[model samples]
Target: MTVAGEWIEKITGPFEDKKRYREYKARTKLLPESHRTAVEALDRYLMYFGSIGKSDVLLRMVDDLIDLFERAAADGTPVRDVVGEDPVEFAEEFLANYADGMWINKERDRLRRAVERAAGEESEKEGESPR
Candidate 1:
């Protein structure tokens, strides 16, 4: 597995197993609130991981996460600014940051494809009738 695959797996795999998720949440709670952005993102990643339940998806996101941190650190993105704000805002900025990153274009494309696929399935189910 790639580094990205390993990262995503480490973050998401635990949560898939009942006992592991409990342990993960417990361990995560011990982390400072200042790390909330990263932690919350990790949590959400786990959620998405469960939703997709695909190892490839998790692998892609793992690479994306590393790139996001490196860029955030190099540009001096305040950790407090991300983690200390509203949850909604944090998610928006979090996704946008990844959307705008250079190293994870494939992951971004993967997300777009997923969204498009969902939309297409919904549209197909709705038939040819106009909205």
Candidate 2:
């Protein structure tokens, strides 16, 4: 999911739209207390990719998902704990839980598919070029 400001705006009605709410939350350093651990984990995970300061979308979505995971974890409802029926099911479940907002899942899936396609193409190219 893309975590559109619209959903946040709707979820937090009368406060402000999603954009304004993000600013408000950022200035106040306010996230559900439960999410502290997960959010911290997320921060560390993000560091591996580079500082969020370098990418606006990454900064926002990463921040938001961390907050969500933290909240869910605190509630004793961590997303990662959800069991899947099988490998494919588990992968889908994991991705869904990891993704935040509306188009986030779609984007993640697209990226995953692209990577897989690239790998397949590379194998085919190698196979055709070699004996």
Candidate 3:
């Protein structure tokens, strides 16, 4: 992307995320009650905690979510069957598959680099000590 485009995304991401999320919401409404409720609850958690930054990645994730729920509704699969027993684990695993633009991952990388740097400096200090 050009510098201008990056700047524009920084400015507001064109507020397009809202539009994509709205589309996801509208599509989810067509799902069966059980599927819709479970999807919506999962959607809420993902939105609040996803920490995804790129608009396109978020859109893709939302679209994939709709696709999954739609198929489940069509097959009359139980929500528990779709998500297994632990919803949080399922949600986290779902998020893990889509790693693009995840702020948490960026933070984790930053932390790893910082720790490595600190460790290197500590080793240097120890090496400089009198034998």
Candidate 4:
């Protein structure tokens, strides 16, 4: 017995189009071992923390990640130099640049709206400004 919400989600869930993700995985395979390992670590981090909501933006971010590793591999650049000592910081900084694609941005907007309503700064008016 499938729920209506489940059916609706099946038709409109995030990442329904996975072609770009497949391509990203293929590209990752071509990198040198060390670069590939660095990428895998960053990919794992991004999957858990990036929370990119838009498919196009996620694809772009992955493509860019591939591009950076590919260039570093070609140039014989060390993986440590590529990701730096604090990789979590590097991954987070990379994610910060793509703020528009992050799900947290939506939650932040919702939080702001709720806070405004509670504080009487916002009204129940249908045409009220988002800010």
TM-scores for the candidates: 0.34, 0.30, 0.78, 0.78
1-131: candidate 3 lDDT, tens digit per residue:
88988898788766577787788889999888899999889989988889888888888998998999899888888899999999999998999888876988888988987786666754555675322
The count of residue-pair clashes in candidate 1 stands at 0
* TM-score preference between candidates 2 and 4, better one: 4
Per-residue lDDT tens digits for candidate 1, residues 1-131, read 88988898688674345454454456555544544357657658545533434444444544454455445555677665544557556554545533433335667788877786666754555575323
Worst 10 residues of 2 by lDDT: 47-56
Q: Which pairs, if any, clash in model 3? A: none
Clashing pairs in model 4? none
In order, how many clashes per candidate?
A: 0, 9, 0, 0
Please report, as a residue range, the 10-residue window in candidate 1 with the lowest summed lDDT: 94-103
Q: Rank the candidates by lDDT, best first.
A: 4, 3, 1, 2
Model 4: per-residue Cα lDDT over 1-131, one tens digit each: 25986887677654445767887899999888889889988999997898897877888889899999999999999999988999999999998888899999999999998888887677646566544
Clash count, candidate 2? 9
Candidate 3 regions off by >4 Å? 1-12, 15-18, 121-131
List lDDT for all candidates, in order. Answer: 0.54, 0.49, 0.85, 0.85
Please give the lDDT score at residue 115 for candidate 4. 89
Task: Give model 4's TM-score versus the native structure.
Answer: 0.78
